[model samples]
Target: MPRSIDRHELWFGSKLNPRRNSLNLIRLVLALAVLVHHCWPLMGLGGGPEFAGEWLGGWAVAGFFSISGYLITGSRLNNRLGDYLVHRVARIMPAFLTCLLFMVVVIAPLGYLAAKGTLSGYLSTTTTPLNYLFSNMFLKMQYADISGGPYGVPYPGAWNGSLWSLYYEFVCYLIIAALGLFALIRKSPWPITIAFVASVLVQANIEKVSVFLGQNYDFVLLMRLLPFFLGGSVLFLWRHRVGLHWIPGILAILSSLIIMSAFPGWGGPACGALVAYALLWISSWLPSPEFVHRNDISYGVYIYAFPVQQLLAVYGLHHFGLAAYMTLSAGITIGLALASWFFVEQPIMKRVRKGKSDSGAPRNESKSSLPEETNGIEKQGSITATTQVN
Candidate 1:
């Protein structure tokens, strides 16, 4: 048997040392799934197919958050808050900024020039690209309109609609950081648990609360995203006691699906737990490709795919149907993602992480190089807990 499969079997047979599980391939899969999901809407086909009022894109985003919750929490608990924040920024900002710049300088301008057929006209209409840069960079939830597309995309005007989720994910990161700090200060897990429960309760009652406050709110979006994030944090906080058995993991997934089918309103929290555990189990049990372990281009793929899809639509490929659009967009997007990772994201990340680690050497709180796992799996592997990012 291959060494990777052997390692997997050993981890499984021993039922110990589950900390070495890597989710690189899983993350890439989720990112590609998001790309696929966006193809429908970008092709001007309504808002895409939905099951139980939830689309594949929604599920994929939830999966990303659940994984982020677990991995980010693990990151914070194992590193100083400053180091944690630096790593987070390094992982997200480089690719994001690159995308924004590309959109502002290249894609939007070309689209406008294509429509207007004049340099002066394109230059005159610069507000949209500038707004896209500033707002998205700040995570302000404001999107830029790529004006003057000849035929335009179905979701015309909006440059990159997929980016809105980054804002919420950052908010979750802050919450985890605060809770991690409090837990460290108090030397207890109660504070984290209490905060998690409070967030869940607030999310559950968000609609009523929004009414009382006289404000419109996206209750479904709020409820769907936050719980999974919190669930991942909780799982990491209690990892020592949590069992990684397959039977229970399978049961939890089945039960969550059944509950979601029966009771829509209250089913979210259960689904959050189910998704988090399922993701964790898969990452832990499966043997990922060596290339996945070495090169994490999922973030690049995610941050680039939407804009590429939109560009394809702007060029009049929206009529090429879903299969053609998806295949071509994914092909171009993956190529761009590779460049983003190798040239921008990975280099910036390596520098920032190295600098932070060196500067915080005296105060480094992480034990050894890897997270201490109770399950006894020797995880001197390429992917460490701290290295698993969104």
Candidate 2:
């Protein structure tokens, strides 16, 4: 028989056991949701599903930020500055760089060969392979194509439109790191609470604020995403007091929908807290397979799916129809994701942990308290979070 629900026993912090949770599964589903959202456009089928004036991928990305905010804040609080940086870098960069290289060496070449019947002059053209790699190596994604190929796709000249958000996610990491430098965030939730409120207000008044900010794209995006991130941060800081009961979770969902319906402009931003709360609540009782708990390939799926979809489009695979196209894309992307986890992400994280262990440095109890399963790259309690589409 299932355990009985007890209102007093449903505090979020207590239910958030690192040993067992559906967060990895939730993240994987979010990453796949992004892939599905892009499938419509990549297949020239118009936008995918939308709710409350936002695309499905937008919601998925918001979920990613919320989860990241909670996990990363915990990570920072429990880790030394240097160890935190190492884990963050190790989790995100290696696979990302490998994906870029794969684009240059494999995907882009195939596109160039298909277009020109040869690989001649492929490296020297505008948006050359080297240019694409170097320009986006830092995560900003200035260049999305290689040698100006990947032509004839629905999203032409963009090998990977999914990478733009990574820069913002990294920026959020830096923001938390900077905040961690202060004793205020460590002792109380006031700092994150104030930041979340300010971000929501800015999002509500983005149009007027854009006038003074000269319509800067980065500023607008940061404002759009920062609230959810801070929402998660605030939740982490207050987890002990926040209950995860089903009644309140349903209320949060309804409240968010009502607010979005009544006030579209700021409703989404204002409901970040509610959204984060609901997500955690759902995760509390969600059942996930043991494989997902042990192996997190969501990050790999995210960074590789875009380019793979573009490559399939370049080959005119969308002509096979959406079902077949999506099937192939998902299969190939999952295979690549598995490879990335085993070859690049997992091994590197293991080495980093090993090095820390070898150094004989004392482990912070908060982090050490996390389940052994979560010690790997992008695991449940790790600060290195996932990314998404633009």
Candidate 3:
């Protein structure tokens, strides 16, 4: 006699013991949260979150950083800086540049006003082809202050509001890169982490003392976030050391609710750190529900959300409730997500990143050996991917 198995449920709960499978899902969720924060203004909704000097916008941005903290540091902590950079650039920039181009030529020309009552006026400072190309390559100038860098004609005059977060995100990359260079020198996370932690502490405290000392830049904002960013490093440094994640996991859940509940703008960096730890705990236990992960139309939704919401609001189509907005936005976004995933994201990344062999077999994968955890790929003979991060 044979017993029937609930294969789907068994597959779903294969990791009832918890695993890192959920990292991608976390990223997708954070991206969507950012979209919601941007959409709040378009929908003309007004209800402050309960605690602290925070808002949904702040939490959303922080979530992005937290995820970055995990992925960038987690991947590079054990690898060569060059390899890490190559892989990260391959993963992040191709699609990002694609959207940037579309934004510059298509969205900027039409122009939509912002929550602050500005028209993204004179946006050519970073929105032009030359500027975007140069910045995207050499400057990483997606979100720099126009005054801080080169600006004017044929540059960004109009850009997405999300550009601000992108700037910080890139900075985090550079910080990790610099650390990677030093990794060869030091060969340990202890010294780098100590210095980083100190830097953040100093950054976090400067403002409190500045009132008596004069208006100096408060370094605390940075100090507050470094600890969380370091959390990722900790995960990598001791990936095999995890035994009891539920404690940190529960703290992650509670802190997330609290941080989001409270509208602390700068606090996002710190709270996001807490959320980072939370992510470590939950990465495997709750990989984005299969439908979301397999479908993963999030990137499309994120790119298209602002413009669509703006156009809709400008034309007074925002009378719809939040649920309806999410529904419609999801549908519209899915179309683009599918298109980009199938067309732009998949094809270009595949072609450019893949090296050709004389026999027409792929050689790029050999050049860039993937960590077991991140190899979301399966080939003909070798089966390398595992359910955990290396």
Please tell me which predicted candidate would have the highest TM-score against the true structure.
2
Q: Residue 257 lDDT in model 2?
A: 89
Flag regions of model 2 displaced more than 4 Å. Answer: 1-14, 365-390
What global local distance difference test value does model 1 have?
0.67
Query: Candidate 1 lDDT, tens digit per residue, 305-341?
Result: 8888887887887687788888999999889988997
Worst 10 residues of 1 by lDDT: 367-376
Flag regions of model 3 displaced more than 4 Å.
1-20, 46-51, 109-159, 183-187, 206-227, 255-273, 287-291, 294-299, 351-353, 356-390
- The candidate maximizing lDDT is 2
Candidate 2 or 3, higher lDDT? 2
- Report the poorest 10 consecutive residues by lDDT, candidate 2: 381-390
What shift in Å separates residue 196 of candidate 3 from its native position after superposition? Answer: 4.6
Q: Write the per-residue lDDT of candidate 3 for residues 15-78, one digit (tens) a residue.
A: 2122225555666676667666655655656532424655565555565566566556645554
Candidate 2 residues 1-390, lDDT tens each?
A: 012335544542225445455777888899999998999999888898988788889889998888787777777876777877777887788889999999899989998888888999998999989888888999988987789878888888888888889899889988998899999888998989999999999999998998898999999998888888888888777765665666788899999889977886678878888888787767666777777766788888898898899889988998999889888999999999989988988788777777877899656432322212222122232123221100
lDDT of 1 at 277: 73
